[model samples]
Target: MNHRGVEFTVAKTAIPGIWQWQFRIGEETKTGKTETKIDLLAIRRVQLRIDRELKAIGQRTGPEPESGGMVAGENA
Candidate 1:
């Protein structure tokens, strides 16, 4: 699924414990052929980037992380 400039691909496999969510960044190589890869780290980074983009669009919620669960830095 693609929204605005963000392209998100969510996939599920038959393997019960295996799952993959890939982020396709449109980049052309030297040959001018558009290629795609699974950018796991970029997907994770999107949380921060998306928040900024959202706020820029007048959707302000302070600088809170886009998660509903306890983050690693929060006190348990």
Candidate 2:
């Protein structure tokens, strides 16, 4: 599964109703499990975690732009 240039995988686990997801970036790998079995939600969660990690290391791509052409934290 490719999302925003990042490749990831969301697979169902042996346990019913449980899903596992994994994604790798460079030499870093992230993994998690969700009970919802919704791939999109799991992917979003993973993306958020990655973003948080990147922000902690000061490697984020800055705030995302909001609607009306305004970026987050920007004063109109």
Candidate 3:
């Protein structure tokens, strides 16, 4: 799934009822596990996490860049 300017995936782990998810940003990547069997729930959790990260840097909390000067992380 793609959200908050990054493409990520949620997959079932070998554990009885755990899901693994990950997403990558420039020069950074994050991964985590959720104890939910539902794929959409896992995706939503990751989206919330991404929102937290973007909010920390004053970046727009959404996918796709706005019509402006530069993107979130870029050489300017």
**Model 1: per-residue lDDT, tens digit, 1-76?**
5545656554444544333444433451111111134445434444445445545655543565677788788898
TM-scores for every candidate against the unseen true structure: 0.29, 0.57, 0.69
Off by over 4 Å in 2: 53-76
Quote the lDDT for 20 in model 2: 86
Cand. 3 TM to true fold? 0.69
**Lowest-scoring 10 consecutive residues by lDDT in candidate 3?**
56-65
| Predicted structure with the largest TM-score when compared to the true one | 3
How well does model 2 score by local distance difference test?
0.74
Residue 19 C-alpha lDDT in model 3:
91
Cα lDDT computed for each candidate against the true fold: 0.45, 0.74, 0.81
Instruction: List the candidate numbers ranked by lDDT, top first.
Output: 3, 2, 1
Worst 10 residues of 2 by lDDT: 56-65
Among all candidates shown, the one with the greatest lDDT: 3
- Candidate 1 vs candidate 2: the TM-score winner is 2
List model 3 lDDT by residue over 1-76, tens digit each. Answer: 8886788888999996699889887778998899986777878899998888767656554555569778668987
Clashing pairs in 2: none
